[model samples]
Target: MLALDFINIGNGDCILIREMEGTRQKFALMVDFGHDCLVRDDHPGELDPRSQRIYAGDFLRELGVTHLDVALATHFHRDHIGGLGRVLDAVTIDRFYTTYLPPENAPELDPFHPDNNLPKAARSALLCLQIFTEALQSHPGRIKQFELVPGTETISLQLTPDLKMDILCGEPALYRRQKEIYDAAFNGERNGYELVRWAKSMNVCSLRQRLYYHGKEIVLGGDAYAHVWETVNLTPCDILKVPHHASFDSTS
Candidate 1:
């Protein structure tokens, strides 16, 4: 049986997927871990009292899951990967996947930088990437493998005899284009407003994933925007994790 747990993490996303044989979990995968605040006791968001909120790591421990077969971070948004540091502290991941892997020579855009006047969205993205990078570095030995989901082709993996997963979207070209704009702005060649505009529209580069269990199909749309769907091939699915929290710009 295939079990999917969509954990309640306020405004973020945390999904756990497991394939079970009777009561034993044969395989396990996690998509995102939600924001860091959700794992903290002093979370400021007014959550529904009846709905219990738990950190991704705690939730895994409660379910007796110690090692994840695979973990995918669809994008660098805080709402999707902020709590990953906490999760890494609690569980061992066998393989880690992401849409973009920062180049080793990437510029340092920290607060101390002379031209660190990035807009809110750009700053937030940088922070999220920094946190994720730190988390991975902290547990280098724990995670056995790391890979980047390719933008040019779909990667199909056979999870089990009856289960499979397809990495459907990853646009390194789009990411590079935006990075160039970001770099120009940081170097004073372009205005900060241009970087802000690009940041707001960067959701188009988020990854889109699809899973097949038996004959049923489930689509995990990450934060992809409407225009992204127009370019990719998406089939009918039994369940769809609506993109961008089902915002006005989510659907095609």
Candidate 2:
């Protein structure tokens, strides 16, 4: 059986997936954590600042996971990847997965639109993440990064013989055209982390995943823009984590 847990991490979502059983095999995959940047909560009660925010060390200890074979950061947004830094601090990761990064100061404005009309809040978040990415690149022991070419790789969990996972996104490209733009901005430093020039712009969130093997599938859709999700080939799973805080018109 698959031991899956999807906690309502405030506006953002956090998913925990585990499989296998006894006999020297066990594993758990924790998805994103809650974000403090939300308007309301379904639960009507007092607010707790300490609640929902999944700091890396605390989250791992809470789940009793000192390390993870796989850590997937679907995209580079605070809500989706906000807790990644902290999580890395607590757990040793075997593999890290993420989509492409835009330029540092060079942003490809929404061409179709006249001014790339973006909300003030989103713009602020993107700026924060840029700094975060810089840090990610500088971290002494950041988890190794990998390109998840669809139909080229699979994510499986073998605790022993109870659960497994399979996932694919960008099989297809979330933003194929933007790749060139993001590439141009890279200066290729020794740190080797992808860098982007910041000109002030953003797009739909980008994140996708499905866990299964012994009868369980958890789908995590990060804030992939329409360009990303619309083209990607995705098979719906038992548990579907919505993208962009269930936003009305981010990525459907």
The candidate that achieves the highest lDDT relative to the unseen native structure: 1
In model 1, the Cα lDDT at residue 234 comes to: 67
Candidate number achieving the greatest TM-score relative to the actual structure: 1
Q: Please, what are the lDDT tens digits per residue for candidate 2 over residues 212-241?
A: 564656666665445556765666677766
Quote the positional error of residue 136 for candidate 1 in Å. Answer: 1.4
Candidate 1, 51-158: lDDT as tens digits: 788878888888989899999987777788888988887888888887665544444446234566666666665566666666766666777888866566788989
Whole-model lDDT values for every prediction: 0.77, 0.52
Which ten-residue region of model 2 has the weakest summed lDDT? Answer: 189-198
TM-score of each: 0.85, 0.62
